[model samples]
Target: MKINIQNYESYCLLYIDNELSAAERREFELFMQENSALVNEFNALQQTVLTPETLLFEDKAILYRYDEMEASLPSSFKQSLYREEAKVVDGYFTRTRIIGIASIAAILLLLLGYQFYFSNSINVKNDKENRQTNNKSLKLKSSKDSNNLVRVDANNNLENNTLTKHKSEIAKANGSKLFTSNNLPSLKETDIISQEIKTQDIIIENDVVTNTISSEVTNNLVSDKNAISINNNNSPILNNTNIPSETTENYNTINTDEHDRSIYIANFEIDGDKLRGVTRRINALFKRNKNDKQK
Candidate 1:
């Protein structure tokens, strides 16, 4: 570490003048052992400052004496002597001006270098901050977009589920209306219902019709047959004919003629109480003779 001799000027001067107290002189000697270069520079500066030799003088004798002293000292020590002389002259405005314009030019160059270094550092720091900010903004936008996409998907799924439930509820209401009472559907209403229920994904429209007719006919037949054979077979009978067997396969066959097409079923389920639902042509056709007769 380079100590600033400027702060210890009095101690350095006392040492130079051989006026230090005995204890202070001992401390100074120990300090010199630790910092020879500093002691040598201080000693040289003190000698130059104490001497009456005017640095700006052009006298040949003065110049010759300076040259002789410079030759006797080591190169490093001579440089330090010149440096000390320059420091003293630098403080005096008149002496600085007298030293020529080149010194002023050198100081200006050092100041410009310092200013340029600081400016470039600030620019680099600003550029880094801008890049970081841009990256963070992009990340935030991406996260927001992802969240929006997720919400949109969830909403679409919810809408589809709601539509399905509504269709089911309509089917149930229609089935209950058909099984419990007599209400004839108009031709126009039938056509509209058929159009609404028919899906191109199903094999054929006629298949759906056939399945409905088959379910109704089978239920009626079983009911009528039971009445006829009830006394002959006294075994307790359960009315399970309303539910279609799983052995019934879905038909993929189709016919171009609208009158000769096969029937297909879309859904069939039994509730906890065994109130069977037979969804054939987007509507439930229940096992009620009065409603069938009306239709």
Candidate 2:
């Protein structure tokens, strides 16, 4: 009698048909009052009473069951397809066994095919590599033969003479790079150092003409900070140089001045003396001054 959303529908149908008791009818009336939106639904239920319809099929013969219409296999075909007295069921190959054997045979054939193809590919690659190596050797040999068999005549036409069958080595000025390998030991530290030094002291020009360059040129090259006093004795001679070629009649490039250069140390000036003599006099002066101070 206490109708909810689920049981209210049945209660409403019972109320519509007057099949509900007084208590259920009162509860359903209260439910309908609370849900006034479903009044149309209640009112529409009476019109929804579906009457039994007499339906007629236009193709009534299709619905009829006939003996010939029932599909069935022929006796011989049914006997062939029947598994009841089958030979395979009489302790022979089953469906599972047949399928397993087929899979095993497929795998075996694949393995055998792969092995044959692998072996053939390896053989083909080896044959191709061997052919290439042989062709390269033959080309080198043919080129060498051609170079050695070159005709001596300017027009390269040998009229009567024929080449000797015996192999002969002709000395060629321009030829392929020939490798001359030696079994020398690894270079030591000293050998490496000597090789580097030899490479460092390479002379680009072996012959040089020595011209008499005046002292003015040498003085111009010298800075005031590094001034040098050279007397006429040394003549600016260039030593350790290659001997002048007879073809060039030029003199030595560095030529000393005719007069000696004056040497100045602070206010004191020393002239007309060699460097060694000037150094000795300066030392003697310092010694005398020390002796005087002691006395």
Candidate 3:
């Protein structure tokens, strides 16, 4: 139709968008030529032309304006967010706390172990020194007393004889009474080796319809040469009944029968009446710290 200044902008938009007919387009071009000053406006409107949209927003649900919703932070996050406002949340022994406690316990264990070992060693050393001095004094006294005593018979100086013998026995027996765990073997002489149980698998048929095979286990060490054979009726019989040889040698505990099971600490030696309690523990620990130097 007739293109005016007001409608000319609309015509230019149609032309930029390629929505005008050929006749309308020619008329729009001729109007632009008549108003050469408005050509800049048409050029600006052409720049505003939006290209065809390849990507489209399919979801119309989120586009609708909704009411504001109340938001809440997690308790853990709230505790961190508000320093003074946060109450004492009882997070009973968190992983970090447990780890810290465990670390302290381990340190305490090492400290206690060190104290027990060193203190016991010192006590043992003092006892040994005192014991040696006492033994020497007792020996001197016993010899002199024995030389002076005039025993007419077995009954004469019975008290003196008993005391002398007891003193000598006590001097000779320098070790303290030692106690050790039954399961744990001494490291001094025991050579513990892990042994594997060897096994040989024998195929035994379990078919009920056809040839059914029967298997028998025996304590006999020898296996039959003709272990598998077809019977007269065509059913196979497994005569192999020998148990594995390695199973027999399986031991529940380390065998200390070969030698006397004496408690001996490899690192340090403490001569006393008998090794017992903490001393015996030290003896056991010797096996674990085998590399420790002999002191």
Q: Tell me, what's the RMSD of every candidate?
A: 39.8, 40.2, 32.3
Best by TM-score: 2
Query: Local distance difference test, per candidate?
Result: 0.39, 0.41, 0.42
- The model with the greatest lDDT is 3
After superposition, the stretches of candidate 3 with alpha carbons farther than 4 Å from their true spots are: 1-92, 148-295
- How much is the lDDT of residue 63 in candidate 2? 79
Q: Candidate 2's residue-wise lDDT over 1-295, tens digit each?
A: 3778777667767886789888877878888999998788888885676667999788988778988778888899988877775454444686555755665565565456545645655665555434433332232232232322122222211211111111111111112221111111233445434433432121111000001223342222121112212222322221232322212122232122423654333334435246445445645655665687689
Q: Candidate 1's error at 177, in angstroms?
A: 46
lDDT of 3 by residue, 47-95 (tens): 8877878997889877776555446677999878775655877698976
Query: Across residues 252-289, which tens digit of lDDT does each residue of candidate 1 receive?
Result: 32342344332322222213121112222112222243
Could you tell which candidate, 1 or 2, scores higher by TM-score? 2
Error (Å) of candidate 2 at residue 234 is 72
Q: How many residue pairs clash in each candidate?
A: 6, 3, 10
Better structure of 2 and 3 per lDDT: 3
Ordering by lDDT: 3, 2, 1
